[model samples]
Target chain A: MQLEIKNLTFAYNKKEGNIVDNFNLKVKKGEVVALVGASGSGKSTVLRLTAGLEIPDSGEISIAGQTVAGDHKFRAAEKREVGMVFQDYALFPHLSVEKNIVFGIDHLSKDKRKSRVKELLKLVNLEGFEKRYPHQLSGGQQQRIALARTLAPGPELLLLDEPFSNLDAELKDKIRRELNEIIKKVGVTTILVSHDREDAEFMQAREILMN
Target chain B: MQLLKTLKKASPGWFLLTAGIIILLLIPNLNIIINLFGEAGENWEHVRDYLLINYFQNSLILVLATGLLTAFLGAGLAWIIAAYNFPGRDFLSWGLILPLAIPPYIGAYVYQGMFSYTGPLQTFLRNNFQLQLSQQYFDFMNIRGAIFIYTIFLFPYVFLMTKAFLSRQSASLLESSRLLGKSDSTIFFKIILPLSRGAVVAGSSLVMMEVLNDYGVVKYFGISTFTTAIFKSWFGMGDLPTSVRLAVMAMLVIFVVLFIEKLLRGGRKYSYSTSNIRPVSRRKLEGGRKIMAQIFTYGVFFFGFLLPTAQLLYWSFLSRGGGLMETLHFAFTSFLTGGGAAVLILTGAVIIATTARMSSNFVSNLLARITILGYSIPGAVIAVGVLLFMLQLDGVLSFLQMGFGIEANVVLSSTLVMLIFAYAVRFMGIAFNSVNSGYEKIGESYFEASRTLGKGVTETFFKIDLPMLKPALMSGFLLVFIEIMKELPLTMILRPFNFDTLATKAFEYASDEMIYRAADLSLVLIFFSTAAIYLITHHRRRKK
Candidate 1:
């Protein structure tokens, strides 16, 4: 299993009931899984917990056989080797598309980082637009760039929170197919959260209903 | 062992940086508290028996009166500008904040110079109108005069905060109140006032803090507030212990005020539940009401900023002499010191703010909060604390010298370094708040995204946080720089014997009754501060 979450429980406040209670999930290597739920149904919480963006109140989350978070040992998100695409496509507004993609790969050689950024740009079909800032890109284009940036680090696991929610109806199906192809081509273990049934069906992934 | 492991696993650099800054910030205040428990000086009895009650009475009256008056003027203007459309409303919206550029002490002297018996207003009245008014009628040198001066210059605190609050308030609530047969005045009293109580308390507490912090105004006006008492005991009576005692008393009063303010703003969060947050639209007034609104706002702007500024300009232009180079030299020194201190403070603030952002743990939050305590304490108090701390350090150095044959004398005290350190302590909170707001606006999503992209904390901060926080860093620097330039009490207390900033220079000339000579320096101070105010407000409005 590339990603495993066992008996995970989380709450924002103790007085309020748990948003995610006794949640468990496992994704095989190179597998794509979609967690579908309504708003406030802990769909994003599952992804966040898996990626170590949030610490589960109780239970275990391991990525690629490395225990990322558990009782008495909570690894930081940065050290977990997990990549996330935030719901809003929280791109660095200040950096150009090329700079943002190469941001996570700074430890690599300068020439290698540059070549990887170009490869990711080509993978996302944004080959000619590396100089544009996030604000200058269309919503769908920004989403693609967010995906490419997340994948730049070659994380063992990738999590996407409502990835297609920001797209329009006319472009959603096209972008969804394109994004699915890119993920399959990269062949990384992935968990995607979405409210739309079409998004899960299009991704050709096993669906888990969250409530 | 578990706790130690957790601490070890957490970001040590962030924890240590925040802890170190907090310790440094608190040392001056801690010194005051420690000294308060020590022996009382010989004059302590004299102060307690004769002068203590007077100080208490004067400070109470000044704070209360200024608080009420500023609340009235500030809230009233805020309401008018927020809820109504009238002539100069746009100008008054930001223009009202300009008075903050003129320090209250400078305002005090300018008013005195204009209204004193032999001053311009009285002289003009006697010369042209043949109205030889009595000294009492023209006098603005008493406690009442101090209140007037403080209210006019300090009400912008209430105005800016209340206006910001009222502007963001949901309009539907007011509309519903009106539709339910409530009159405008009735809705204002029964609904608006009740909802805005928190903002009023916040602004009033700020006014009270500034009023208490003031040494120059009360001292120049001959009003014996606690700050003035502290200065007198230290400088006039040469009694450091008594000064510390007075500072502690002042801090006690501030603690009570802050506590009351906290009580007023209880745990109840006041936010609109729905996303339908349509701001209150302005009502266009016609005829008499429009004219009245215009008169009220313009009158405040005129008296608070323009009139005093005009007088300063006139005096400066009239008194052009050989001292022009000397005045420019003081301005340069002021800029250099203010710039240096602002840089140091912003650096410290950025570290603390970033740590507070990166680590959402209790320790970091507490450290950030503790560092801001210096801002609320009076500058004179901080000066006393700084003085005591530096003196002790000097004593330690001399002791080491006696034992080890190393020669070092008062390295930190009696130098520009002491003054800059004092500025950092006094103004670090201002810079921190500005940067914190910037951090708050950007939110944690970007940082979290960076972390999830396999970037470490330090790498993420350098790549993501710093670039995003540039605007905030600039604004914080500018705000602290302007404040350092306008600061009087801290600079006056901590500066080297022969050192003079624009503020101290202006104050010296004004105290010596050379108000004309003071004008050149005052104009330079106001020019920089006013320009900064305009830039800050412009940036804020653009952000909104």
Candidate 2:
């Protein structure tokens, strides 16, 4: 398994009780799974826990045989080879397209980083748009760039939190197909959260519904 | 396998540094509260019996009067400018803010000078108008005079806050009221006043804080406030313990009033952003109404900003005998101190605010809030606390001087360091608020985004957060610097022998009755303050 979680329970405040209670999941390499649920169903919380953006209360999270969280072991978010695309895209407004994509892969040489940016931008249908800022791009373009940036680092696991929520209905249908195609081409284990069951079906993802 | 345990931020370095800085800032302030229960000095009984009740009563009257008056004056102007449009309304909207540039102490000086028998007003009355008003009627050296000075200079705070609230108000509410055939006065009293109560209270509390924190106006006017009493105990009587005791009392009073204000506010923060908002349409005032509105605003602008400024410039040019070298040196000293202290303050603010943003724990959030404690209390209180703390520190490190055989005062002259420490204690909240607003705007998403991209906290701060926080940081630093530039009580007390910032220099001259000589430095202070006001307005307008 590329990623694993067991007995995950978490709460924002102790008095509020568990938001995600006794949750469990395992994903094999290159598999795509969707956690489908309504709002406050802890779909995003589970993804966040796997990405090391949050710590679970009584659970273990292992990434590629390394215990990244829980079980008296924790790796910082920076060290976790897990990438996430926030609902708002969370693009650094200050950085250009090229810089935002290259931000994750700082260890690579300049030429390699440039080529990677070119390859990813072309993959995301954003070729020759490297010099433009995030604000200059439309919503679809920004989401594509966010995907490109996350994929540029080539993480072992990818987490998407309501990635298609910000799009219009028309854009959502089109981008959903493109995003799934791109995720398949990259061939990385992916966990995406969406409230709509149709998104899971359209992406051909194995759906796990949560209340 | 190991037992599951709580996992927090990976690197504890920044969090620890933030905690350490907060504790360092707390030492002087907490020292005063700690001493409140300690054995009192010999003079405590006498001060408590003779002057304590008077000080408490006078301070209550002064803060309450200033708070109420400024609220009425400021909120009234805000309503007029926000709701009605008359000729010169455009300029007056921004012009009314100019009075804040003139410190209340400087305002006190100018008003007192204007009302004196030798001042221009009386002299003009006697020489040309053949009207010799009684001295008693014209005398402005009393508590009434202090209140007047506070009202003129401090009303801008309420004006700015209320105007901001009103300008962003929805047009629907007013339009609906108009559709219902309510009169203008009915809308103002029934709707606008009720809605603006929170902002007015917020603004007036700020006015009250200034009133409590003030040493300059009270000291010059010989009014008996907690600030003046602190100064007398510490400087006049050379009683540090009694001064600290008095400061603790003032702190308690401020805390209680602030508590009531917080409760009254009901934790409701007004953020009209996100939703589309149509600002209230301005009604055109005509005929008698227009003339009256114009007269009122112009009168405020004249007394509050123009009259004092023109006088200062006139006096500055008249008494230009202070040597160029001496003036330049003091100017150099003022800028250096202010700029240096501002830089230090902003650095601490950034660290504290950043850590607070990153951490989710309750303790870190509480510690972050504690940094603002200095700004809530008076400068005199902080100075007394810092002085006593420094004396204890000097005693602790007196071992460093055991072998030198040099004089204690000369060898241990850590005055500049103490001054900076005191400044960080006093103005940390101002800078923290500025930087924290920036943090709140951009939020932790960027921080988390950078971290997932393999950057550490420090690297992400420099690469991601710092770039985004530039405008906020620059304005915060500048505001803090300007504050330090005009600060009187702290600089006057804690400044080393022969050292003079712009504030202390002007104060020294004024104390010696060289009002004209004082004008040189006063004008200098006002010049910077005016520029700052312009920049702040420009920044806010651009942001809008």
Candidate 3:
């Protein structure tokens, strides 16, 4: 399995009951999985837990056979080698498209990092957009840049939280196809949280309906 | 039926609080206006001919010099701590604000005691290094010295404001800059500084207003600024009109500063360009740079807080007869008065903030703006207004007493009531801002939800708003309490005969050239204010 979770229970505070209660999931290598649920149904919480943005109350989360979070041992988000495309795309507003794509690959040599960024930009069909800030991009274009940035890190697993929610219906289908193609081409294991049935259907991923 | 319907439609608590705040805010400024139209006092000619120009020149110089110096020091330190991860950065980040706990007047005395001809620094140099320095080189009792004292103590206002602004910035932007192969210095100059211009300006303006409002540092240093001019005209020359005139001029200068602040921020939005606002992440420095960063941070902490604090500790114990008993008494009394004033201000602030949150009517908005005017006006100016208004009120009470056969004299002004009232007038703005932000964070949706569930406005507020606003209320109270504890000018002008708070006691001893005796009391003030600041900042950090 590329990613595995067992018996996750989590809550922000004691007063509010567990947001994610005994949630369990597993994904095979290079497989894409979708967790579909309405708002406040713990879909995003599960994604965040997988990304190490929030700690689980009782559970084990592993990426590429490494237990990143469980029991007394927990890894920080940056050290977990997990990539997340947030609902808002979370692009660095002050950095251009090319710069953001290379943000997580600083360990690469200069020429190699630049070439990698250029390759990802071409893969996401964002070539020649090296100078534009996030604010200047369309929502669809911004989502593409977010995906490219996450993919540039070469993580074993990717978490997308409401990736299609910010797009219009007309742009959503087109971007959905393009995004799926790029992810499949890269062959990165992916977990996507969505509320739309069409998004799950178009991604051709096995869906888990969260309560 | 109409009256009850109108009452049901509007919260009477809101109207009552707004009206009360408006009256309280207006009385001081109204007194000044009425006094401006009155006849000139005997010394008005002397002040107008000779002293006015000096007052103008001195105040302008102090404000400009202090503003620039504080901005440079504050913004530089804020950037250093905000962006760089060095040894002691965590401690130094908040430790730099400790100077604010020591009042500027007390700082002046401590610096003086450390550098005087017979003081520790010179004596140590002579004994150890066989160095003989001229007295002229060590003399810091002048305009430049006053500016130095004010900047060292007041720069924290800029530092804190700018640090807060920088810390809220998205960390990813900086990380991306680094990933782009830009150096730390390049990222700072190109990205960090430009984004923090608004905070820098806001902090500098606060420093300027504080300089204009100060009476102690200037008075002790013998610099003839507007605040000291007002004091001299009123106390030394016994000229009320001239003092009032000087105060009005000072108020005008404050207004000009505020206007320029507004102009600088004109049409420039400072909100984050994206919704991902991670707290700023500090970049660790290495080797020599790390050592240099540590030295710079500690050096600021030393000169700004530690050196003065060490001097105070030494003096407090070095003095002959122990003033610990007197100091304890003053502490008790200061706490009592400050606590009382904080309670009253918090009550008033909660009502006003809740009302403003409940209603966005023209009247509520205007009342909100009016109440904040007290903070911008100099403390001494507010004291002048409060004194005049209280005297008139006392006169009315005396007339009523004669008609009713009562024999009490100086009804309101003779007690601690007037001083506490003056504190409420001046520091209410502090409480209001905290509580208002609390209200804003809660939003109107909760209130609307409660109303739809068949609760009245009063019920919704007590059950929903109060519980949610506990943190804000507590912080607001603590902030106001600390301000009242450290307050000097208002307490000085309005305290009853023979009344003494810690601030007044310390000031009296220092002015009497018995700074050692003053240290015993000043230390108590610093300890309490520092503890409060520590608690408030710590609580905020934990919440984040």
Q: Weakest 10 consecutive residues, lDDT, candidate 3 chain B?
A: B1-10
What fnat does each of the candidate structures reach?
Answer: 0.76, 0.56, 0.00
- Candidate 1 similarity to native, TM-score: 0.95
User: What lDDT tens digits, residue by residue, belong to model 2 across residues A15-99?
Assistant: 9899999999888999999999999999988987787777777788899988898866778788998898888888999999999
lDDT-sorted candidate list, best first: 1, 2, 3
Which residue ranges in model 2 land beyond 4 Å of their true spot? B1-10, B266-284, B320-324, B400-414
Rank order by TM-score, top first?
1, 2, 3
Interface RMSD of 1: 3.7
Q: Write the per-residue lDDT of candidate 2 for residues B225-296, one digit (tens) a residue.
A: 888888888788888889989998999889877987788778456566557889999999999999999999
- Among these predictions, the greatest DockQ belongs to 1
lDDT agreement of model 2 with the native: 0.86
lDDT of 1 by residue, B263-369 (tens): 87795377877877899998899999899889889999999999999999988888976479988899999999999889999999988888776554564567567
Where's the lowest-lDDT run of ten residues in candidate 2 chain B? Answer: B1-10
lDDT of 3 by residue, B26-59 (tens): 8988899789989988888888898889988888
- In candidate 2, position A5 carries an lDDT of 87
* Candidate models: Cα lDDT each: 0.87, 0.86, 0.83
For model 3, the stretches where C-alpha displacement exceeds 4 angstroms are A1-211, B1-10, B179-181, B361-365, B408-410
Model 1 stretches with alpha carbons more than 4 Å out: A14-18, A196-198, B1-10, B400-404, B408-410
Alpha carbon deviation, residue B176, candidate 2 (Å): 2.9
Q: Model 2, residue A63: displacement in angstroms?
A: 2.1
Q: What order do candidates take by DockQ, descending?
A: 1, 2, 3
